[model samples]
Target: MVYDFDKLWNYNKPADTEMAFLKLLPKALECGTDYHLQLLTQIARTQGLQQQFDRAHHTLDEVEKQLNTQAFPQAAIRYLLERGRVFNSSGNKKDAAPLFEQAWQLASETGNDFYAADALHMLAIVASPEQALEWNLKALHLAENSADTRTQKWLGSLYNNIGWTYFDMADYEKALALFEKCLQWNEKQHHPMEVFIARWSAGKTLRLLQRTEEALHTQTGLLKEMIDKNMEEDGFVFEELAECLLQLNRPEQAKKYFAAAYNLLSKDIWLQKNEPARLSRLQKLG
Candidate 1:
């Protein structure tokens, strides 16, 4: 309760967040309620986010050493969940699934529906599309039924993931529906960043569905909202708007947004790696 891991939640830079967690560890240890171990769990998570897999593994080992299955049910579930997450993030879903399943079992036994839903959600992520949908639906059911506020907040994430899975499988209608659901849940949270993300997904899905005008409208509105709120400027939205304009034959507007997107996104290593072709086209437009 005293240790605020929430501070790390919105930090996009995992390496910096990991350092922040490390700085808090000694002070957290003095609190004397296995708080240090909980902090270690978060540190391991940040290491995984930073792609420091081996260091993340070592941190989890330390967690394993301190974890008591009987005495700390919640912590035990978190340890297993974090272990599964590390393996999942490291691209070892085969190893990850069992850990998530075990965590699910532990959470169920402990009557912790929030963690149980989380394990199911992770299982969905690492599974095949059809199996993933099944798992996701089950997780959604648990989340919806739980009285815990944390579980309720998971609605947006579950919808977003399922939406993307549908999108990847080329089911645009289903994807759009789920993305809309995500947007609805995010609106309830009134978290600007999350709402932006949900809108982005919805707009992208609209583009995939060839609803160019709708996609353009959605992205345009979202961009204005972000600008008004001084929210994190997402290059993806600009790129999406550009593409939508291009599809609608507004070449001049498209070119402008393409240039804007290029200026913002060209430095992103992940974009450079995964979307080189699209980036190249954006550059050509610029």
Candidate 2:
């Protein structure tokens, strides 16, 4: 039975989809064609997203062995981009940068603006603060000018990264503005997930700006949307709402959300490692 891999991926359940790919590997091998190479690339990407870096690299190595770059230029670009993503996620940005650069050059030469913008956006993510904005803006330009729906879909992510680069540089105003830009694009795409993510960034930036009232409004709306969508497992939004409630001197409301956040966060090991302090504070709120 052939699986609709794209549909599986779009379900946003990467771990399960990756497992499905693994189970299908035997059937994929039976076909014994370059098409399996593309399937391997998809599996590698899911592994990268799961932070199974070693496994991802192994999968990518198989793709490299089978890839006919002359015939599959787009797949070549995908390979480079996925390899770069794995390296970047693993904190080997130096290794990642060259891959992204190669992808950018290849995509540009192929006149594939979608991939060109993707490669540039990845380069922006790994670039230093001084260069990140420039790379991001270049990607943004391609995304803005392109007619491809694929490039248009990238708008929210490009704006979100630009906003974070500004945030990291402590340019709160620019960060807030760019996050707003992300939401506008997300709305245009009718992508609720990206809109919520952009709202989270905007809300956090508002808090940093000491615009607590605005933050409160943003968090309230975000929390409502999340709840309505039954996406309460996203503990960060709960935490954001709680923080805003705390600032508004509503301890009772804040405590409930803090507890909710803690409950959800405890199940996420990545969040546990990245936000130890937040977890600690949430405990105290109880």
Candidate 3:
């Protein structure tokens, strides 16, 4: 646990994650302890951030070797979730399905409702748009059964996710309503990530509505917050904001945003050569 937390703080989304390797002793990990599983999960997450997919799986395997199935059902659920996440990240949704199912089943049988709900949430992400609603609604059911405030917040995130899925499925009316309600949960929690995501979603849906000026105003705040936090902004976010700017007949402002987005992404050598949208936008600006 100490090691994991230390690594998180030191990195704190630091760049060049492949160069950020700090090895942990296998013996330091005591299976079934909250900290142990947390360490394993963090290592997996770190590898994912570094884009080292195989390394992440190897770390999970180490944790698996130490965990006993009979004694650690909750941990079992966690392991499956982590593995499923890696598969999802790697774009291997089919491989992730069974893992999520196993975790969901274990969480249910063990009365670990929160874990069950979490599994359902991730499972829904991998499912098709048509099938996703069932998974999310099932997750909501399990979440409703829990008494924890944190659990409720998670369920709220699940709802937000469902709303996004609906939006992707071309159901704007449903998406807007769900997102509006999810804002209440985020307000109560007042977490940065939640606020950031909620605003992003709102702005996105408004754009779909052709409410260009409103969407620009909404995302502008989020952009300032991201900059203030010194966090990396997704190029897609900036591109979308520029789209709104163009719709608002603000090509000058659009040029600024387009440049900013392309520049930020262009710093990464790999993406500089690879991202046609950003690169082409820059060329167009020039």
Best of the candidates, lDDT = 1
Error of 2 at 258 (Å): 2.6
Q: Model 2, which residues run further than 4 Å from truth? A: 1-7, 19-34, 249-253
lDDT of 1 by residue, 139-181 (tens): 9898888999888878888999899889888999999999888
TM-score of each: 0.89, 0.87, 0.80
lDDT tens digits by residue: candidate 2, 122-222 = 99989997699999999999988989878877788898999999999999999999999999988988887888889999999998898988998998888
Q: What TM value does model 3 have?
A: 0.80
> For candidate 1, what is the TM-score?
0.89
Q: Which ten residues in a row have the lowest lDDT in candidate 1?
A: 1-10
Task: Report RMSD (Å) for each prediction in the order shown.
Answer: 2.3, 2.8, 4.0
| Cα lDDT computed for each candidate against the true fold | 0.87, 0.86, 0.74
Scored against the true structure, residue 72 in model 2 reaches a CA lDDT of 82
lDDT of 1 at 228: 89
Choose the strongest candidate by TM-score. 1
